[model samples]
Target: MAGFIEKKALKKFSPGEIICLEGDAGNSMFIIKSGQVEVYNTVDRREIRLAKLGPGEIFGEMSLIDGRPRSATVRAITDVECVEITRAMFDKILAGSPNWLGVFMNVLVERLRIADKKQRVTDSVEIGKKTVYLISLMLEKEEKTTGIIYKQSWKKLVEDISFLLDIPPSQVSGILSKLIFTPLAESEFNYKDGKTFIVKDWERFLKFTRFCKERYLKNITKGIIEEFEVKSEKEVKFLKFINEILKEQARANDIEMEYMNSKCSEILNEDISKYEKVISELVKSGILKKAVRDDGGKYILVDLELFDIKFQKYVDIELFENILKKFEN
Candidate 1:
């Protein structure tokens, strides 16, 4: 303890300089002496701001007290000065402290443990959903009648998915491995060929996977729903009108332009001429498709049911099914 107090040094940082990185080992804590620093975690290449520390505030205390890896990165947000407290000094201080200090440390450790667990659950669900969504789109684009599509090696595919989604490869791989027990089980990996394939029943599997993904990402999708609500104020009326007309046209199974125009004029009390561009825009955007029946005539097909990205089902059948697995031999 002779030189512990005198040996303590002031650390300085420039604005935008990294003070510490997430996941690195750290045994020292910093108490801000001047200016400000930002603490953050990177998930999917996005910096999630955790906290900002200014004069007299603390950073890096969790790892120092808990003997764990750093959970987040810290960067100086402004030119800063801090008093560095190493583990040895920390132990020295604690050794001379009152009984309440031990209680305080225990409380801090418990709170940190709970917070860390919540973050992991949230991130795992998000990464799982995104991985399923990407794979579904890839299989859909292949247009194979039997839902068979070959992709690169399992490891390379995981890396590619991580790169595309900006998520960590470990999180992507871990979440996807759980998909093996679900309907997506038909997807098989061939390490020898350095490739994998989606074999069958993918349409049903994807719908279930997508719904599960949406459920887990309710907070994120809430923003999307809000934006859609704003758009609905402008577009919902026209969309409803068009969808109703398409439903009526199903008997004829033909969505000719002239019929839509006549119906629009009759029911909407407006010229169909103005909405022609909207219809064309819908076709161009793949919300509506032009197709031909056995005869020579062409018609437009629209599936307005799935236009909203939100799920319609109220119950999670998957969860119920899993509970039933308890009776398995």
Candidate 2:
């Protein structure tokens, strides 16, 4: 069957070209005819190589068989040639051969892969601790600079931590809950305003974070190969968009609230009313100050130092300008 497929015209890939990305719809499998390809999964924004396949190996078959999204990304390691087999061709070939055994084997391999991934995540105690420590540091930075940590800030913090630590946001949330219960830190939850503030015991919390770093540095630093939990890329992009706008306002000292709302709606591709609650929460938490301008227009002011501390790394001047281009009149 492999020889039969290789007899057909093969697709070529340049070194370093992406063949398929994780989470993309997968309808075909590739049978390597020459050169090499690397398979990897992205965790915490870092790529973890799974395997390097040379000629005669297959990739992307699991997704084709299961009718699911690609679980990992594949890229060319060297100039490569592969025979692409679509689902139609796969079915036609299976129908003529004693392929029930092949189907069963593929199913068994996929199930084992999933189970192994689950076991790895369950065993990653040091990774979980390091994630909590990072979140604590972020909270401490926000509190010391802004005097209050808003609900929106917490949402962004969790997302950022998930992206950085390559863990699920739910896992990060569980770690945060445990940290809040610890004696090293105290939190004040404003039910009315939907904000949580780390109002007490800052020094102790910082010390705890330092302790985690010292204790878990070795295990955390050791590179471990594991399947990455996928997250919604759009949500991450949206959070970055919000941070970019806030950073601009922080730098300018003040911005017209109407203009801010319009830009947010444009980026979100939704009505500003959808985010009124979030804006209100920001105001209630003191991250954003709402005031009436002398000319009777409404505006919001941000603390420049606090904003810089929170979003310095997330800002990209080129990306910001390109996003703003769509809103230009």
- Pick by TM-score: which candidate is best? 1
* lDDT per residue as tens, model 1, 97-210: 998897799688879879877776656555666677776666555556443543434566587788898766866665555555555443464546654545365545565565
Alpha-carbon lDDT of model 1: 0.66
Off by over 4 Å in 2: 1-3, 42-51, 99-103, 123-125, 132-178, 181-329
Q: Would you list the C-alpha lDDT of every candidate in the order shown?
A: 0.66, 0.65
Give the Cα RMSD of candidate 2.
18.8
TM per candidate comes to: 0.51, 0.43
Error of 2 at 183 (Å): 6.4
Candidate 1 positional error at 280, Å: 51
Which RMSD values do the candidates have, in order?
14.2, 18.8
Candidate 1 regions with alpha-carbon error over 4 angstroms: 1-8, 13-26, 34-57, 68-80, 87-97, 145-160, 187-193, 217-316, 319-329
lDDT of 2 by residue, 1-329 (tens): 66677676378999999998999998899989899999998866778787999999999888888787898999999999999998889778777778686679678868967985775654455665566467666765552544343222456667888889776676666665555555544445466645453535554445445544544553566532221111234433544656678666554767776787788777777765665665676566566677997899998777566555334323332232232222121
> Cα miss at 192, model 2 (Å)?
22
> Which ten-residue region of model 2 has the weakest summed lDDT?
320-329
